[model samples]
Every structure is written in C-alpha cells, then in structure tokens.
Target: MLLHESQLAQGVFNLTWKVEMSGTIETGHVKWFNDEKGYGFISRDNGQDDVFVHFRSINSTANRKTLQEGQRVEFKVIKGPKGLQAEEVTAI
Candidate 1:
C-alpha cells in the first residue's frame, strides 16, 4: 500500500486512513526469491501489495526450504514489523 505524503499527513491529523490486514490465508506467485538470502516477496493474486516471505515460513518436506520464482504458494498473511508478511507458506 503506497501512501502519498498528503494521505499520511491527513492520517496524522484526522487519524482515519490506515493499512489493515485481513490475516486470512491467501494464494500468490513467487515474484522473486533469493535462495541464498532465504527471503522473497509473493505477488498476491488478489492484487494487493506483495507480501514478504521468509524461508522459515516455508513449509517444506525436504531439507532445503526455498521457493522458486513464479511458483504458486498458499500462505497466511500477518502484520510484520516492516509490513505485510507471509506465514505458514506451502507450495501449491
């Protein structure tokens, strides 16, 4: 959710506008992933902002926990320290 300065200013004064997460399970495609870094962003199918996905969140049966680019995945959305993050991610 990209916010303009005007909207941020208005929120500061009026305290109305805000970003909210539904905390629901969602499906998306892996936009890009760095296997070495063990982190990536998923392009949500719902057209929302991309959610950050950590390797730890990946549900893998193998030893390596990594996601490939363009892979389809299902995950739960959570409000992370930086922004929206993916949790309990599983390949679909």
Candidate 2:
C-alpha cells in the first residue's frame, strides 16, 4: 500500500497539535456523555475512540449545560500528558 494510504488508514498523519492553542468550529460526535458529571468523550474526525472534554472546556456562549451522546460540536485540542484533550467546546 502507498505510504499516504497507509497513513490515512492508520490515522497517524491526522494527529493534531494545537500550535495556535485555538481552533475553529470543527465538529465531532459525542461518544459518551454524563450529564451528572458534566464530562464526556468526542469521536474525532480521524476516528479516534474518545477524546476527553470536560464541562469547564465548554464555552459559556454555547448556552448548553450538557451534551447529548452522538451530538456533533466544535472543539479545540489541548495537549495532555498521555495524549490530547478536547477543549473550548462550542456549538456551531
């Protein structure tokens, strides 16, 4: 297989680094949601299973207290210790 195709299949080149510490309203599916805890994971575009997003990262302007599972919303990635985390979640 071509390297590009392999990369695409493996979702390696798709990794995101938050150079700007900010991002546009790129949407992702909510994988699991816990309204009581106010935290959840989003299924990112590159097929990642779960990217953690806390309520604190959600924008107040969003006007939503909690997210529903499978809901698509835009967010930014913040570098975390083990991997990456989604932040600044906002509806678009």
Residue-level lDDT tens digits of model 1 in 10-64: 7685333223466678999999999999999999999989999999889999899
Whose lDDT is greatest here? 1
Cα lDDT of all candidates, in order?
0.87, 0.71
* Clash pairs (backbone) in predicted model 1: none
Off by over 4 Å in 1: 1-20
Question: What does the lDDT come to for candidate 2?
Answer: 0.71
lDDT of 2 by residue, 1-92 (tens): 55677777556433544333436545688888798888878888766546788887777665566887878788877665445678778755
Which candidate should be chosen as best, given TM-score against the real structure?
A: 1
